[model samples]
Target: MKVGVVDVGSNTVRLLVASVGSGEVRSLEEGRAHLGLGEEILLHGRIRRRKLDELDAVVTEFARIARKHRVRELETVVTAPGRQGGESERLLEVLRRATDGPVRVVSAENEGRLAYTGAVARTSVGPGVVAVCDVGGGSTEIVVGTALLGPAWVRSVDIGSLRLTASLLHGNPPTRTEVESARASIREAFSGIAPPAPELALATGGSARAIARIVGGAYDAE
Candidate 1:
């Protein structure tokens, strides 16, 4: 089946059109638009009208692209913005209007599970613990579990590159103090959570992939 998966995230709206079958999947198309919904919500405690309008436009475009690819099913998954207080309904409405498909808000735990599942599926491993880390705009999800069974533990921390950048880094290039402040804030946020040890650590999301590419000269799931 050809499915179009729409991710309505805090910093960006992304689309993935893929063909899934018995034991394999093929990517047909992928695209993303920076919406910055998290920045507004974190600062003002609600999604502003301007951001909503921008999101509507972007989602409409993504829907057009999905249609162009002739996907059999369209599903929109809303993350952090949809979990925000007093803002989920408005965000869901915008996505539904734009995609004309089923839109659902996934809780932080579900998000962690989804991330971990996707990451683990890409690995060539057996019945061993695999740790998956998904660093998004609004939150960072860490999941550890057996590859064949499922996640045994999931922790969603409220610290991410975009959130920290928006909240702490004010200058064009942040100063040393600003960098330290962001690091300390992230450390404090992760202080409460402890995840299980894993045989393999898989990093998902944009920042992790970029870092892997730069540091390792390539991206590797292992």
Candidate 2:
């Protein structure tokens, strides 16, 4: 069956159109756009018209691609953007019009679990009490479970790279102060985090992979 997944985040919007089933899945189309939905909302409590326009474009494009792929069912998932109030309704209305489809306002915890299931289906790491972290432009989710996939606990924090970058870091490499501040905030959120008695942690996010690539690149350039 053809399935489409759209994640409307704080900094960007993304679409994943794929064909799935029978233990096999392939992405037929994907799209992304920078909308900055959480910029002013983090500071204030609303989204600006400029950012709304950006989101419209992203949603329109995603709609086109999904139609082009002839997807049967499209499932769009939205996180904190809808619950933030202050301006969530307006933004959601705009996006719904852009696609003329249902937009699901998923709780942070549920979003975390779904995303983990999707990603882990692609790659399940070493056997143990697996702790999964999926971070986006607006929130970070941590799920702890056993090798048998029994539930342990799930947590969601409102801190993403863009959120940190805007509120704290403003440089490409981010200053020491910014990094330290960001770390402090993340620690506060994960203060109770114990990793479900796991041996190691599994981190999944653009920030993690990008940092890894850049570090490797720097070493190779030497």
Q: Mind giving the per-residue lDDT tens digits that candidate 1 earns over 22-45?
A: 988899999999878888888988
- The most accurate candidate by lDDT is 1
Give candidate 1's whole-model lDDT: 0.87
Question: Candidate 2 residues 10-80, lDDT tens each?
Answer: 76688999998998889888888766777768876788787778788888888888988888887677876
RMSD of each: 2.4, 3.7
Q: Which runs of model 2 end up more than 4 angstroms from their true locations?
A: 171-173, 216-222
- Off-target runs (Cα >4 Å) in candidate 1 are 217-222
lDDT of each: 0.87, 0.76
Q: What is the lDDT of residue 118 in candidate 1?
A: 86
